[model samples]
Target: MKLLTCPLNGQRNITEFTYGGEYHPMPDHQQASSREWAEHVFFHDNNAGIVIEWWCHSASSYWFLAQRNTISDKILRTFPADEIFNQRVDFAPAPEVSSEAAPTTKGESC
Candidate 1:
């Protein structure tokens, strides 16, 4: 079994944690069209590197940010989920991709 280290606590088993998808800005549903909706549901960039993903500490009722090593399923770094959440982030949100830019998968949604 893999291990999960909580930023607030310490090393905890992986069973106590859950994987959350990549962090991105929520698109405005009202202004989004059918194509935009489809893109949002299916088109996500699978970038490899240190990405800040959400980790729910089911055993502790807490959330934290994890620097996930996507290639190996190994965690590089972790900290109190709120450390990144509470900070004044100035990062540009993901680009609004067109539906045509999405992959040609059969019926899977990202």
Candidate 2:
């Protein structure tokens, strides 16, 4: 059976982990347009070289990052997510529209 090391739990069966996705740095949320956001969320480079990716220890719910070779399908190393994402990405809720501006909210009383 294949094995994968968890930065927090040490070596474990690969079955215990979940492949999150490619660990690409997020785009500037404040400056990125809707199209850019769509592309970032939906697209993957699928590069053949070594790339950092997000992985989770399913049993413990511990998430981490791993460096893997796409062509070889081998994980080189694994580390905590905080090592790369030092800051959290918060999506601010859209401003609520007033009754005067939105027809849907005019008579809908909940």
Candidate 3:
């Protein structure tokens, strides 16, 4: 069995934690369209590369962030969510696109 290091609980069985999906910037609901909101709610990149994700320690009910590489399944580091955000990075509002700039297709083009 694999182990995942929790920021608050130290290293523990992977089963002791829950995968909370990739971390993403929350978009402004007032400016976001139905499609943008739906995409944010239902979609994930699932890319085969390093990604920052949210994880919860089931035993302590503590939530934190983990930076891991999906291809190697290796966790690089773990930290409390607030610690990561304490850097004061600004989350800018999503850029507005005109209808002419909107994609005509239903899905991403290869």
Which candidate number has the best TM-score? Answer: 2
Q: What is the lDDT of residue 29 in candidate 1?
A: 60
Clashes of 1: 2
Off by over 4 Å in 1: 25-43, 87-110
Cα lDDT over the full model 2: 0.90
Which portions of model 2 miss their true places by more than 4 Å? Answer: 97-110
In candidate 2, how many Å is residue 39 off?
0.9
Put down candidate 3 lDDT per residue, 1-110, tens digits, no spaces.
89999989899999999999998876775688889988998998888999999999999999999999999999999999997567554556888999998868787578
How far is each candidate from the true structure, as Cα RMSD in Å? 10.7, 3.5, 10.3
Q: Each model's TM-score, in the order given? A: 0.57, 0.82, 0.71
**Local distance difference test scores for all models:** 0.76, 0.90, 0.89
Report the candidate with higher TM-score, 1 versus 3: 3
lDDT of 2 by residue, 5-94 (tens): 999999999999999998777789999999998889999998898999989999899999999998888989998988877887898999
Q: Residue 88 lDDT in model 2?
A: 75
Ranking by TM-score: 2, 3, 1
10 residues in a row with least lDDT, candidate 2: 99-108
lDDT of 1 by residue, 20-67 (tens): 777555467657788987877777777887676778888777787888
